[model samples]
Target: MAGTAGSGSSPLSAGGDGDDSLYPIAVLIDELRNEDVQLRLNSIKKLSTIALALGVERTRTELLPFLTDTIYDEDEVLLALAEQLGNFTGLVGGPDFAHCLLDSVRLLAVEACVSIAQLLSQDDVEVLVMPTLRQAAEDKSWRVRYMVADKFSELQKAVGPKITLNDLIPAFQNLLKDCEAEVRAAAAHKVKELCENLPSEDRETIIMNQILPYIKELVSDTNQHVKTALASVIMGLSTILGKENTIEHLLPLFLAQLKDECPEVRLNIISNLDCVNEVIGIRQLSQSLLPAIVELAEDAKWRVRLAIIEYMPLLAGQLGMEFFDEKLNSLCMAWLVDHVYAIREAATNNLMKLVQKFGTEWAQNTIVPKVLVMANDPNYLHRMTTLFCINALSEACGREITTKQMLPIVLKMAGDQVANVRFNVAKSLQKIGPLLDTDALQGEVKLVLQKLGQDEDMDVKYFAQEAISVLALA
Candidate 1:
């Protein structure tokens, strides 16, 4: 039994043996000082993995100083040093070991520059990593500086609120203007994070003076990616601000994106309206955002139109029926006939809400005729929504519209190309059964229920059975 277990632990086997190997540890420690960069690196990696598996405390008493020294050894060996330090520092060294750890971090943070920042980030061990990070935020290398901006973000979460905002805030502000676009992009994302959780007063001050100006400058950045990042930050801040008690200062920036050259940016800008309305007042929505919403309602991009549909109800509350009188009502009506199934579907749902809000006059004037046309659409989804829309419109207008106008259209859709339509149309006719004074279309309605009762989809089959049961009760 002992020999069988030992066989599984053999290093010569491709599979990892479960047995402890003490020989590799001593060999790697000796190779750590090797002049050959590759030999030292491979040795350091082996030792680091051993330390990770064994314990950092076990490795630290022997390996800490050597890892620190390697950061300045040469660029070729720096990566090896960084990887080892990441593993070593992350271990449970505690406060008593802070001096050796802090000293090593200083060299990486200030002098070794870029390589050290990568080390600090790679390990991201808050206890072993932050002191070096705090110092390196002042590094002379733009690459090092950019890296610090990123590490500060990760460390801030790990370190909690211990590091002063004063230390990180300026570094990020400077990074926002870095000559490298990649650095600028990274800094923008970091700054956005910082602003989110920064103490409320501090965040407000930064928004008023620092962040807002930086965003305006960054929004027009020649780098489209940077502009996109800035746009996202603006949108996030707008949402945060929209919920904040004090929002007078943030509204202008939120509104500016409505005209952004990028359609996506414009869409994000509009999305913040509800938040803004929640914070400021509905009047700001009615007065400031109406035209942009109208323009977006007709947007060539289906996504942008979808966004408009999402916000239209909010705007309607502020601007009232006058806003949708010609602009929104007519646009959705036209969309009901759209070739895109999603657009047609969205139009049907929104029209249901619209009829519910404005009643039959609005449905008759704006939606009823178009939805009736869609009852025959080729797209299965479109046909389903069209039938659902007629049912919804009848409910919105009461049974009078069902008896007077919609029953024939509902019966016609009972044989729709899609199964859901066949089910829903039958179900919709049953809802109007008690309300129908005459049996003018009673035979057609019976045929719909008969066909639906045998539908393959269980939902259709059940609703069809219910429709038949209701007809029998009548």
Candidate 2:
């Protein structure tokens, strides 16, 4: 066999001509096992030449198994073999012989296993593919376990309902609790998908009785990534499980994640609040909503705090004006002067949405005074934030509030010491001009623009002149 394998006369080795004729299969085999990595890599690159000389049957029986054994070789050698695989189709006698190569294709082997299982007879799948996947699901490598967990829904689909309920469900249970965090995260992400794809006949029973228990464990999984992945899609289960099951089984888990230490996890849960709201109603949701609100509102990450501020109007609308004033209104005001500019800006936009939700009276009596009082704030950024709020609020507050309530602040800031603040005041005046009646636009607004247009700073003067032209007060 070694003598027959050593021949290099095969047609597939034609390009080598006389060059690699010196490197026969027997010599290459020795080199593949050679202590030197460069020599092994050279042998791996010439893999198809060796396969051609060995013929299809021997390549399947002998060559592929050898490559599989040596897969743990240097990364470069493995990469060389991988690059050679796409060209191996005819060398391995085409697609029918492709499965022989599947075991060697580790990168996408999990998906390949499920795909191949679909084409085989059910008896073969039960007897053959099931055992291989079961082994892969518990493989010592976390990567292997992750792939099994990641592709599990597709595997369940290919194997039919009975086998899935009997075999894959138990395997999925182990995967969801796999010791590796990556494996658990992968499994956690698949929880809803796997449940959704379960046979309609027994899905609810399987989820309520079998899957929900592990999901409960996963929701509190120590790894943030796992919890984040779960939170992103877990709410979809509300409709599937119905209002009763969601309230009894999942709502606590949802609220727990909303207060999770991880910002991404909290954001994901908040993003899906509508799903839970539809299932449980706003009155029931409000009971747990405030704690989640306070938790996120005070998050150390500005982006997280900014996210909660963006949700305030919707929260305020559902919780109503009285509850908002008591619970959430202070948080919104605090955000107007938040240390982060992005938070202050989002807070400005949030007020517009709230005014739109609750009307101009809410803006005037509830929010307008608090926002306007920031003109006296000692910090310039807070003072600037006051102007930004005026810009955002002017349109929503309408002619009466714009002319009487908010317009006085813009005119006062136009004489301020800071050029940036003066320039922003010019911008605010222009933004609110259309919202004002002709008298205010041509009177107090025109005087502020004329004073700012002659200011020492170029930016303040430029913006002031632009506002004059824009408001047609020139």
| Model 2 lDDT tens row, 328-429 | 889988988888889988999998899999999888999999989999888889999998988898888888888888889889887788889999999988
Candidate 2, residue 25: Cα displacement in angstroms equals 15
Off-target runs (Cα >4 Å) in candidate 1 are 1-21, 24-49, 52-58, 68-92, 102-131, 134-147, 151-165, 190-192, 201-203, 235-249, 310-327, 353-370, 373-388, 391-405, 412-442, 447-474
Task: Give the winner by TM-score.
Answer: 2
**Candidate 1 at residue 388, lDDT?**
66
Model 2 — which ten-residue stretch has the worst lDDT?
Answer: 1-10
TM-score of each: 0.63, 0.79
> For candidate 1, what is the TM-score?
0.63
Give the lowest summed-lDDT range of ten residues in model 1: 1-10
Task: Give per-residue CA lDDT, model 1, range 377-465, as digits (tens).
Answer: 67776776766677556767666676667887787776666777777777787776766654543566666777777877788888888
Native RMSD of candidate 1 (Å): 9.2
